[model samples]
Target: MTISIDATHLADVTDFLQGCEKVVGSPNVLTNAADKSAFLTDQRQRFTGAAIAVVKPGNTAEVAAIVKLCNQFKVPLVPQGGNTGLVLGSVPDSRGNAIVLSLARLNQVRAIDPINHTITVEAGCILQNVQEAAFAADRLLPLSLAAEGSCTIGGNLATNAGGTAVLRYGNTRELCLGLEVVTAQGDIMHGLRGLRKDNTGYDLRDLFIGAEGTLGIITAAVMKIFPLPKAQLTALVALQTPDQALQLLTLAQGRCGAALTGFELMSDLCLQLVAKHMPQLTFPFSAHYPYYVLMEISDSESEAHASNLLEAVLAMALEEDICQDAVLATSSAQSKTLWQLRESISSAQAKEGKNIKHDVSIPISRIAEFISVTDGLLQQQFPGCRNVTFGHLGDGNLHYNVSPAIGASVEAFLDQQTAINLVVHDSVHAFGGSISAEHGIGSLKREELLRYKSAVEMQLMRTIKQALDPLNLMNPGKVI
Candidate 1:
């Protein structure tokens, strides 16, 4: 179905565009198809939506003015950052009635308080730039992820993203101290306090952090920073199974405590795909095991101390037969090379063919059992489907992905996405796990969210949504 606008509706849209142009110069208001193409598409290139125009506001005042204009014209607005979100939360719908509110021009580091250990930045600031700024100040913003190079802080907070350092520094939500948001009614909430504790009324910051812009637009944030680690070490340990990996995790945590920064688990097939597609990345192990774990430790002590701690943990694991073989990186270059193999799994899988990805989190104790049971069930229902499982085992999150059987049509395999999701998500629920862990419930998994959440939980979410956005003008058709 398509939306057919009459003369009156078309006139209203024209007036709205003119009003937006007045707020932020005509050059910032993109209405041509060529100008709006990049903003209309998603990161995966899976879906392309339609928007009346892409509006780029220069400052918070302009953003508030444009949002007020949207409300006046009865136009829906989709708040967009770097547009690197995997789900469709940052893109407009196909109705072509909404405007894409781009925050790209609002990029700025508002303040950096070294004494307070916090950095205040606009929503449009790229995550890598923030990290560099922190590094320049001899501090660390440890929200590390693959998309950090291009993903914006607003998108990160909107989705409550969890990345590689989540095992230690926590998700973007935990690292944030405050946020500056533009409400649905064009009101600005100036909550950018760098305080660690504030026993005020309701915690509005928590509500908007993971709302995916359904509640309001995040303009800026105050994020916590930490003293940089003096030394960091990485190691790759080959294990026989997920069970062994879990055992290794327990041992590492018991030995290294908070110094353990990363514990990533990868199946043998994951590296095989990497070797097949990304030939430049060399596999560290001489022989393949059923599974591998890439672990890291960051110490405030010297490099020798960090190395000794990591080596001691690996030595203990080897003595206990928890792992089959291990290779510890002796240099920073070697450490990066080892990390590259762990990070290349997703891209390598994409190069192979179309596949379904499930970012799930299960209890630490039941993860091994969940994998064992779920893999068997998937194979029983859809034989020959390859399971490329890997993720941050320390945090109980797994990127459990699936590939088509060799010689099978990729389209045919993808056609069974619904059935495949049912099999995997059902098992996850059976083990007390979440269907969507780090990624927000964008339109991609909205229906699945309903199936998993209870009626009471759903109703509470809807009540909150209704109270905050009564007209449903803020990013409709997402998260409820």
Candidate 2:
């Protein structure tokens, strides 16, 4: 491996770019501050920074040269793909010394081997286009999300993103069979085979998937593809409590089998927020239960069976007092209407107030306990804190959010962020859960991750980071 960056050679980055322009064309590189400004800030606008330049490598060979040049100059390189990452992994540093290597120009659908039921795509390919390609081949990518239209495959793989379909098809990492990465020194790690099983010597592909570019830049990937579901069933079940939501999940899972694709939980507070903030959407069910779960089960079999399964589950759950009331979507449009209630939480919350949220995870069995305990704890600690809880209950991840007190000043409430974080994270730790669930640690949870991670574990992370990015050039001041 090439030695990392040194402050002494920092001035030579411009010279390196000058040399690159001679070889790889001037149009590919970006040094202007305005263009780089948008590249630096995150979607949340939480963290912003500067980069020496944004290098748009048009192809694999060009990317390799940019990496080699950066390596020789010892310039920190931040590999970026759509720049849609919630985490600051794709953003550059405040120092404005490290180069941002943009992979967007490498967009290509190299192969779609429908025979093998696999698609080989470059990292920069937009996720929507990937889905379209798969659809054209009469298959579904099955990794659907709100950002699917804008996010890139590389970003998804890097974050190991868990979207709506994660309960069924799995996250980005699980869908992956192989990968192609650009090492710190710009060498390609190409092992793009659609192999179902391979007992390779250490799984190097898995390392780069969720490393947040601390290890290597994911250039391309070979991901698993699944057959499109023939029929889909969506339901809105009003539950009395969180435990009932769990029971509904169990009942749905029992009947639907592998087709139980999603079981998303929503607090009545969430629906209220959605209705209050988003005036366009009307509630499918009346304001009744304290909790609700929007579930979708898809099968290649029969819609009748799937509907029957849901009805049976709802009937049993209601009879046993597991759920208060249930309503199945009579049409696709109605189903979408029900889904919109769950999907609009973030925007609704944003409009409501400054959200003090914790995206944490605990054991499935401990979910009921966690919900009950956390609600009480929040009420005790911060008397005015409103507990707006919801998320993928089946996967044991919940967005345990504590909104700013209704009557209190926002700044004052946000002032206790650190203390509030400790309260939530400590509870998560008590349950053997990660400080972060779906979202990457990014700038938000870096300190929390350090606090929760054991000394030995933190040391290992530091070592790996040091080995890959010695100068700390890639997405500096974030993650590890």
- On lDDT, the candidate that comes out on top is 1
What do the candidate models score in CA lDDT, each in turn? 0.92, 0.81
Write model 1 residue lDDT over 1-480, tens digit each, in one string.
233332337767888889999999999999888999999999999999998899999999999999899888778899999898877889987878888999999899999999999999999999999999999999999998898899999999999999998889888999999999999999999999998999899999999999999999999999999999998899999999899999999999999999999999999999999999999998987899999999999999889999889999999999999999999999999999999999899999999988999999999889999999999999999999999999999999999999999999999999999999999999999899999889888899899999899999999999999998887888988888
> Can you write out model 2's per-residue Cα lDDT over 216-289, one digit (the tens) per residue?
78888897777878778888889888888888888878877888898888888898899999989988775667
Clashes of each: 0, 0
- In model 2, the Cα lDDT at residue 125 comes to 94
Judged by TM-score, which candidate is best? 1
TM-score of each: 0.98, 0.95
Reference-based lDDT, residue 130, model 2: 97
Report the Cα lDDT for residue 235, model 1. 95
